[model samples]
Target: MTNLDFLLPKSSPTDLRSIVWPRPMTVLVTAPHPDDFDAIGVTLKYLKNQGHDIHALVAETGSGIDKVYGAGMTQEEKRQLRVREQTGSLRFFGLPDQNFRFLNLNNAPDDQVVDDEANRLFLEKLIRQIHPDLLFMPHGNDSNRAHRDMANMMKAIASKVEWPIALLFNSDVKTIGMKKDFYVGFDEADAQWKAQLLRYHDSQHQRNLRDRKYGFDDRVLMLNRKTATELGIREPYAASFEIDIL
Candidate 1:
């Protein structure tokens, strides 16, 4: 027989399973926009598979649709469509409507400079109510202004909280660089499921095509593949995160 053992890298004996929270923990995943959840879909799916209770919070309705979809549709119509699409996407992951919340904050380019205190308070209230053991948000170094703002807002709220909470930052498409501390690997089947979930964001698909010929599905696959390769993992795809204890 061929020297298969030598060809494969030696496995480490260290048990790193403790890095992830044990079963039955509550997780809160926050996204700057409806479709942003795809950035951390692999980890979310892994957490769900482990029987963890998870909730998704979207910071905005993605009101900049007119810039992407053109002037054909009204803002209200676009908003409603995005809401429906996100709802359907979450449903695919077995999340109930009650488990998903949308802040519906304005995402216009001009309005991006201002931070809404009311929205922060709303998020804090939700965090208090959920009392999640683990919280997921976009990384601070994300190139997207809204993503950076959301990270700052979460950090502010996390500073105010007294109890122990694990904060994990997911990588966005616009993320410049991140010091990844943890990773969740997924097989081809899981990657396909993630792609299917991304397609539920019909509005985002149109926007992605307008900007890039590829959609969220392709971007996610490429990101995950690159992440897996960088980490030297055998999985087809992976999602990386930076962990912090607060």
Candidate 2:
């Protein structure tokens, strides 16, 4: 039997190079909402540093934030605010404007995205156009409807044909069940940098602070810290993911 050390503390440098695609390949990360890209920031940064051609496909404008914050704003105004927040955050991370796109799907009033054929076709066409080697999105078994919807859309696309791609499903606080197959660890410097990057989404930062009594960075870092501790890192941050092929 394999010497399973379930209770033993694992040591590292949580390097993901061994699990990442061996070559410089195109990558697409789908964000169900604007700031989600930051949830897996450490991992995404590592992949970008490795010369992967990464494109971000953001599915929604997070209009719900506007409904609460911008009470009387037009739909376009609400959408643009969310767009500006995400684009600014991406720029802070050194991701060029051309490298990311907003799907701008028509969202329902309660902010839930309608998982219909039109949305599916749009996602399929973009996936075909990008032809990525690796695809990253939130896992399907999540409490958040939008995240689950995004995963469902991808699964549908994958089912239509034999896609030669690797799917990387990352976790956040709302994720219900996930298996952490791979991870990337970050030290103090990286953690501080990620915090700054996350702050670019000021709406989310303020909202989190108001609701949770902590900033958005704090909330995300809390998850990272928990993952690091669970993985046996004494005092650092880590982001984990489960990998699947489709």
Candidate 3:
């Protein structure tokens, strides 16, 4: 019933090659934090290579991350650091800075997303303006609170919108579980490139190292490798996603 409906059965999760959308599409990727976008780099790269118009909407400044790791930094400084890292990562992938945007959404612990009218209206307006055929975001069942909130917010907004849109929910470091309805398989070279993309957020990388005994890059790739092996993908790594139409 949607413009993207054609992608349904044609795009199966078992495919080993890159995704081939029926036509060029406008894609909006929602990131709860700066580095979340890079968590699914290979898939986005494939979409970009297929001539799709891709834009990133970062929902948060990731100041909370700094609040934990940055002992003496000002809030503004923390926000700027994350923005710079995200911008540099996008540049590395050949995306123009103009395509990136910061929603600057508030993260008050007491404000539930469904009850936040302002955020709902803001997101509704932004989605209507972009009018994207596909939306990419982290899966809702993630361990990170921000990631879960953003995913639920997007789903809520999508349900009420007039036009139909495809949602590609991705896996992250904290993703509990998801159905792999689509995927992009990559080799060692591509895996290394993705790692570099994650490495751009050095602050997060160091935090991950100190807390998890590995860097942020490895944390992501470990999941990628496991996903590939679990799905019987021939590639050395794979970025899997669960797709839905709304």
Tens digits of per-residue lDDT for model 3, 166-230: 88899786899898888788899999999999999988988888888998899999999998898
Give the winner by TM-score.
Answer: 3
Off by over 4 Å in 2: 1-15, 64-68
lDDT of each: 0.74, 0.78, 0.81
| Lowest summed lDDT window (length 10), candidate 3 | 106-115
Superposed model 1: Cα runs more than 4 Å off: 1-23, 64-70, 106-114
lDDT of 1 by residue, 103-214 (tens): 7664555434225687788788989999887788889898777788888888888879867677778866678998777677888998888989998887777777778899
Per-model TM values vs. the true structure: 0.86, 0.88, 0.91
Candidate with top lDDT is: 3
Q: What's the true lDDT of residue 113 in model 3?
A: 27
Clashing residue pairs for model 3: none
Q: List the residue pairs that clash in candidate 1.
A: none
TM-score of 3: 0.91
